[model samples]
Target: MPIHSKLPDVGTSIFAVMSGLARETGAINLSQGFPNFDCPKPLKDLVYKHMIAGDNQYAPMPGVPALRQSLAQKYRRLHGCDIDPDTEITITAGATQALFTAITALVDRGQEVIIFEPAYDSYVPSIRLCGATPIPYKMQPPEYKVDWERVESMITPKTKMIIINTPHNPSGQVLLEEDLLALQGIALRHDLIFMFDEVYEHLIFDGIPHFSALRYPELYRKSVVVYSFGKTYHNTGWKMGYTIAPEELTREIRKVHQFNVFSVNTPIQHALADYVNNEEWYSALPGFYQEKRDLFVDILRQTRFEPVDCKGTYFQLASYRTISEEDDLSFAKRITREYGVACIPVSAFYVDKSDFKVVRFCFAKTPDVLEAAGERLIKI
Candidate 1:
């Protein structure tokens, strides 16, 4: 018998593969970009309290009112943008759902969805599942900078959207204002939808400011910005995220979202709203994570592997060219088996790995975990 598959090319995610290997080998589980530490006690307590106070029912199709209002205020505070909480904000299960909904809502069969290579794994699958074509533009290794000319050239009449992630995963590269300007030009010229994934918006380090898609008022009408409480609140399991877009676009995305997850966890959403609205909590995040990033980098400085400068995200890219000539996947497996340290290979994110020799280390663990992993990595 033969079986059909919608995503025949897809398999278990690289994150899952590396994480399972880490578990079996007893390697420090640094392969996945989730926090090993617990979320804020205050946030968790609030959720429990809300549940105790009888707020466990399903929320509004879009999102809980309080949460949406708080999220709108957050956008205003952080990005100096005003979004209508009722019409322009829709919360989903997580940023993943938000991305899927946005893609499904906007993309049509054979339409091109341009994504930067070494991208988050979901982009390609989500685009393909929506019957859209994924046009990957590779970001060069060592310094994963965008090739604007190449990107501009990829924009054709069939191009329906461009997906961008700031504080980019695996590479930790942040999109600059210049990059945004170039993207704005391309989007305006081609009339393409701009989907920005900013789950790591608050995780930027080294005094680099996050560039929001909403910053460009010219492209605001065409942009859908997705953000998550999971990354910011250190609660990946919570899986609560929201998208900000123009009323018209959000309505369509919400249609997909309404049936997808229908609503996020109710009390949790309220708790996150409270947490984000607290100025002190959100304000201190940069310094809080920056210290962890620095400590991890400092520990790896003694290693043979050259750790790339991470401007943002808890993940760091390290070149293994000096350590071994082995390709990224093999090197990653070897490190897990021998060094007892788990990490993700950057090449897995690319369509082709002809010239890439890098792996990604997630530093979202405790200091001791980072130190232990760092010590083992140095010997490799």
Candidate 2:
């Protein structure tokens, strides 16, 4: 008997494919969204310290109280939102888990979820696995701004949720206060649940403030906001993140969270609790990433590829139109095999594989790696 597939069309992630090709070809890999640097030594030490102290058993289904409390203080300091640690927060395996749990917990079969494309690869599949329809609103390149009126137009009785990403992956666009106001209005009118993917909150650049759904009272009540410690601390492999929702919403999310992941990494959560109190790393994140972005963009600007206006996030989109008329996947593969620098074709983010001749390069790498990739890229 043939095994039934939840996602019949889903295959390996494009990020994985490009990164693997880069490894095989001995090319500089900028296709995947991860830093070439290790996280702060102090954080690693903290994890070690806690583990050696023998706090290695299973964590509470909600999370360690200390980490949740630290996170609560963080919201107060950064966004001026007071969140109750005990009832409103739950540590997840990662932002993706937090996202999946929220979708599975709240959304019912046949319920519609509105997602923006080019979106993160996981969104549609997660919605599909839980038997919900993912309605993708295609956003064009350059600006990639959302039209609130258009979003409202897509709403039907079956519409249960609207998910959005800021400092968006593959686009580097951050949502502004106006965008939140529009979303707040629509979600209220339609009674739609909100899922805010703000894992790159601290990674935003050039003095643009991240307007988190947590900052808005009306939005927060009906929202499930996901964050990543990996994104913040340059340790994606840790797979540590959390969700902040209202007490009632969080309660429902934990129902699914308990059985799926149960709890996140224990020692790391302990380390993060102490680490977040300092705030030095997160405080200086914007400038740290800005320098890398400037170096990478400056280098690529000398070539035929045209860089888009990257306001936030470590990813940058450069249109390869001037160099090749080939589709983005072909261009990406050729560049990796021939030009020696790997990148993600933006078309892969879309369900329909909409091609704009644009490809995304990650700038989260160190100066040396960025310089090396830039040197090889300029030859093309």
Candidate 3:
């Protein structure tokens, strides 16, 4: 009756923990990274039309041809890179599954994967499940800049992959062109595969253009770039996402992906194929989220918490050093219970749970919800 857990150290995700606590305490839950508003009605209508048109069954093992082709065209228009839908693109249940499948396929047992912290929670566990080791490089606060020189110094013969996230979660920092160039050089020099998590690609702000790995030939040659339709359309629950890679790499990824989920939802895939063709829908995302960022920042100015510079993504980090010496997790819980506002402790994103006296709040809610959360946050 004794069961040895593959993930013995892992427990309930902090998102679930905080969200459940928020519900119990009647706090305004901003701990999880999801929109509190509905996606466009037109998108919903498209899904209805597709389902009614009998797209409810299993999609192709790779994906529906229409959705893959649309994504291929999207890559061509956005990154100026031509992708073969039949050979290079595959849709998954979410970006998370694509990440897992890619890692599972590429990372061999006893190999090593270098990851930067504070990373998204899923990265480490996925790497561990592959029977590989994760070599973590800590990026400091106030900037979270990667020291490429230091990164190269940590490389070893056993190192097989490097993972990166842009418009990063909890921190919201984006990678610059120089970072991409450095990563390209390193991956080529060591013959290491690179995985780019760009789920928040469209949420960049302040006129800063996103730098995709697809932009560089060297990086794209040895990279798997993951994207999320759920994140893009503000319907995270739909769990639709895809990955782009070279034909060789994608062939390997599909080996795992076929057994993983077989394919994503057929109706959602059909609807997304039609919806993505409209440039107007996605083009406005940066400006849309930027307004929310600016509004949230402006409101936080009324409080003691110092807001960090958020270049992209809908999450905002605030240092509560002036008000509390308590660790981030404790402060997060205290505020949730007493102030009726819930946020994720940034420490939870790090493997060590390193407390930097910072907490992350999701600002992707409605203006009124943000206003209400701001009122509670300001009271602290």
Error of 3 at 39 (Å): 1.1
Q: lDDT of all the models against the reference?
A: 0.87, 0.93, 0.92
> Distance (Å) between predicted and true CA of 368, model 1?
1.0
**lDDT tens digits, residues 27-109, model 1?**
89889889988988998899998999999999889988888899889889888998899999998888998999999999999
Better candidate by TM-score, 1 or 2:
2
Instruction: Tell me the TM-score of model 1.
Output: 0.97
Candidate 3 TM-score, C-alpha based = 0.99
Instruction: State residue 138's C-alpha deviation in candidate 3, in Å.
Output: 0.7
Off by over 4 Å in 2: none
Candidate 2, residue 229: the lDDT equals 91
Error of 3 at 161 (Å): 0.7
Clashes of each: 0, 0, 0
- Candidate 2 lDDT, 291-314, residue by residue in tens: 999998999998889999898889
Candidate 3 lowest-lDDT run of ten: 138-147
Model 3 C-alpha lDDT per residue in residues 189-279, reported as the tens digit of each score: 8888999999999999989999999999888999999999988999999999999999999999999999999888999899999999789
